[model samples]
Target: MSRSIEYGNLMHDAMRGLIRKVLQDVADHGLPGAHHFFITFDTGHPDAELADWLSDRYPDEMTVVVQHWYDNLEVTDDGFSITLNFGDAPEPLYIPYDAIKTFVDPSVEFGLRFETQDSDAEDDEAEDPAAPAHLPAVKPKGKKLKPDETKSTSDKEDEAGVKDAEIVSLDSFRK
Candidate 1:
């Protein structure tokens, strides 16, 4: 007897659909009751762009929080666009759908993961296991710190050092 598992692409498409639905919900009802998103994606992905200045500053990844004080939130077929305050400057960003690496809502424990499609296979034949695991890429100048950095000392103390809830992986959904 022989047995085999089929690694169909259904799971990948479904995960993408799920994320789209989540975003649609937010767009329709305006982030119902404490539900905000932490979206991380590859800034260099084919269809994404930050301000020229932002891209130069954060070449690898960038993450953004969709919560209070955001404006012009629009979703497009290719991706989405919104204006966010960077310190005193309100900058607009356009991120493509394919570039998204991770999408998580800490309030509900829901998350999605995506594969990074390589544009040039010959340039690199393998991935680096020793490098830090990829979370969503985040901008260095943003309000939130990189996932590795902790919040301010006073904020840490106020929360009694309780760890924040996060979705660590989407591998379980894959077949």
Candidate 2:
């Protein structure tokens, strides 16, 4: 079998690393200026943990805003845990990096989208009992965010002048 480079996975890893680094900085030092994050994730991910109500409300996916108020931000190699307020009710969540679908910081008009597939450990075990199961393989997709995907703006001028986020893809540099 010929070995080939997995550019998709590589790009995804790099993006996730960037998220990790950003979160780590925030965890160490508070969010700077008007900087905040809008993180959307797959609530159904095996490693994802959240309140039952949140799961029931957003069975498939959920978006949490990390601005104005948030707490208990703990970042790990595999995932991060945070507490966010929902209608005055505090909810704690643990989201794995593989579970993240989109991460946007509208303060800087930056964003990232990841397409991922969970690996079946059972299938891997069947093929090689001694082999360790692999984590999800993530594919990166750089796209402009839809209007609804962003935080709502009350200013009509702001809405009308909304800027499309720049797509950052590695494909251009690959060749």
Among these predicted structures, which one has the highest lDDT? 2
lDDT of 2 by residue, 1-175 (tens): 9998876578778888989999999999989999988687888999999988667656777667787888999999898999987655677999999898777776765777785535553243242221222212222344433444322111122243532222233223232
Residue lDDT tens for model 1, 56-138: 54566666777776777778666888887655467898877777766767666566666544646524544332232344333
Reference-based TM-score of each model: 0.62, 0.67
Candidate 1 clashing pairs, residues 3+ apart or interchain: 62-137, 62-138, 63-137, 63-138
Separately for all candidates shown, the number of backbone clashes (residues 3 or more apart, or on different chains) is 4, 0
Q: Give the C-alpha miss distance for residue 166 in model 2, angstroms.
A: 26
Candidate achieving the largest TM-score? 2
Alpha carbon lDDT of each predicted model = 0.59, 0.67
Clashing pairs in 2: none
On a 0 to 100 scale, what is the lDDT of residue 62 in model 2? Answer: 69
lDDT accuracy of residue 133 in candidate 1:
33
